[model samples]
Target: MSSHVPPSHRRWPAKTLAALTIGAFGWIAPAAAHFQELIPTPPLVNQNTGATVTLDMTFTHPMDHGPVMDMGAPKRFGVLVDGQTTSLMDRLESISVEGKAAYQASVPLKGPGDHIFFLEPAPYWEPAEGVMIVHYTKVVVDAFAADEGWDAMVGFPVEIQPLTRPYGLYTGNLFSGVVTRDGKPVPFATVEVEYRSNGLIEAPDEIFITQTLKADANGTFHYAMPQAGWWSFAALLEGPEPMANPQGDMVPVEQGALIWVNTQDMPQPSTN
Candidate 1:
């Protein structure tokens, strides 16, 4: 999370401008949308499962299975249960994901209710996009069949308030949520969606990689997931103020409100 620029990444302003010039006309392949992933192993915790769950945090293109990016130490990592927020920063263990810096944590389920895990990652500099990226990401783990409290908000700078129950969904079920920033609706906010790649499916084209949609006047959006897996919904917005880049130059910031949910295939009836 250090703002200091590494000598290896430091480059002259002229070269940076040249690279942008070339990229503007399509010399470089379009970069896939970045998604901050906060995924829980097993996704759901029930009476039949273990007492603890493992969470993986990483910055990457979930749909592309990555060339993962290095993630700095997070600014905040914690969980919310029954309106109480507990910091889990000390429990984070540094890990290598795809040979890139990432993090993992083991969280014990204290009791029944929805455990809302949230992360505020260090700002990431994306030279290609010429912006500092910060994604406030979260995921919900339902424990002991206590289905209440799934709609609680973490009070991030920007976030999605779910209109649909985020867990225990069947494939093709429609998901809905409202985009909010500073506790107010962000009308017509653009949301990017991606399915976590398991390496079994391939995108036929770039269009198939990331799906984009716009929230309505009420800052609400709805999407039906076509497959069974972990899916990410990211509501993108511009930060109110610019941030200093590696070069100490002020640049725009891309603030994202992200949430991850999982769906399963419905079991079919047995033949008599």
Candidate 2:
């Protein structure tokens, strides 16, 4: 959401690499917020579906500097099920501990396209780390969704992956029966997400991750779905966006809005 997609640790596996590079996100650099980093993020959604992914988190040193997490013992931390915050808490659902002792969370996509996720650090077992001013690290993810504005006028499928796993997906959803103003298909147009992060970021170059897709000449498109969640995808009415680019998916796509998409908990219009 910051002009750039947040950093996903996948690009830098070493603990030291992450620490030294903390300044990349000036605001998250040891800021006094309830922020913590959950390595290998987007923490594999739907474990209930038997689809579980392992995620890890780190502290500067002596693990004891953190808190006595709810999962208990090495690799556990307290969690917060946050949503409804749309501003700083958008795309985030629940933050809990995983069996691997890493932080695990369940996030519902808001629509299709690109979106932001800010993971708050877990409470350290000790009060010092808990009270210390720590900045939050960010990871970027691609999200796909349709009809985010409740108009049901447009629809699309979207994908979002973060640098943490570089290849690790974070969202995948679908939308059906999306139509254009003239009863034409929105394919061949384009789909993208317009976003910003918690930091007071400006300029497109500051963004982190953005995944763009184009509909075939027939106005239909297919993109890789990272995982399961709500997503928001859009089409630029006027431009040359969607390209064979990864790492950063947007910027070129400017001035477009939600079209057709798919998401969870949303009911299709009943023909009955």
Candidate 3:
């Protein structure tokens, strides 16, 4: 039951080197082989409801005659929406443990915001089950454009924040709005969110999030919980400088840094 077993680093002891050389007609023994590297990557996609989202998680290895192990059943896959995790689908396209196919998945833009997804191989390894190691992939999707009139800023989104798990709310969730130049909303602007840890930046422990959202009419937007982590939200104006309100002010679409927000602490995922 010990999980800290040491790795086999050496081939033989010091004394064995002499005898092995003289055992045969100078028949030099072949080198020891290393364990095969797994399918380095996991498949990911911005699947939508009613849309065909292809499932292509092919790795560096080949398909017909590659170094892949069958998972018999697709039990090692899972899915997550925005921030609330969901179960992986079983009826996918012509795909296996290491295959790829054009799948159709309907992206549900039921509302305006950013939807983030994380895809990775199931961690548990078993010969009776499949591969020796596991992996995962990640992706993001944005559907919005404000200022022109198609923004959700004027009113609440169709999808309300859930009060509990499977439909609950979290603090890491992000919100954005159309930035105006001269009392006018900037249409079709993009917003990005980054994380800062202990006042320092660029640290992996406090890295930036790849996900971004678009602004709707009137220059407003929002991105739901993508993950359970500390983050700073920022807004930008894609269009030209807004004529100052006679006072003289100028700012770019890149709002420079993220806006800090307070989030409620929640329990970590249960291992059971």
Best by lDDT: 1
Model 2 segments beyond 4 Å from truth?
A: 1-181, 193-208, 239-255, 259-272
Highest-scoring model, TM-score: 1
Error of 1 at 98 (Å): 1.6
* C-alpha lDDT of candidate 3 relative to the true structure: 0.31
Candidate 1: stretches off by over 4 Å:
1-28
Clashes of each: 0, 61, 37
lDDT of 2 by residue, 13-105 (tens): 444455667856653332111223344334223333232222343332111123323322222222212222233323233434332244444
Give candidate 3 regions above 4 Å deviation. Answer: 1-52, 59-72, 94-112, 120-131, 143-272
TM per candidate: 0.90, 0.25, 0.27
Please give the CA lDDT of all the candidate structures: 0.88, 0.32, 0.31
Q: Tens digits of per-residue lDDT for model 3 on 1-272?
A: 11111111112332256447676656443221111111101111123333233333332122112334333223233333444555445533335433532122333334433333323332223222111322222233332421121121111111112111211236554444344434355554444444323233332321132345666665566766544433433342222222222234332111111222223457789999
Task: Indicate the TM-score of model 1.
Answer: 0.90
Clashing pairs in 1: none
Find the 10 residues in a row with the least total lDDT in model 3: 1-10
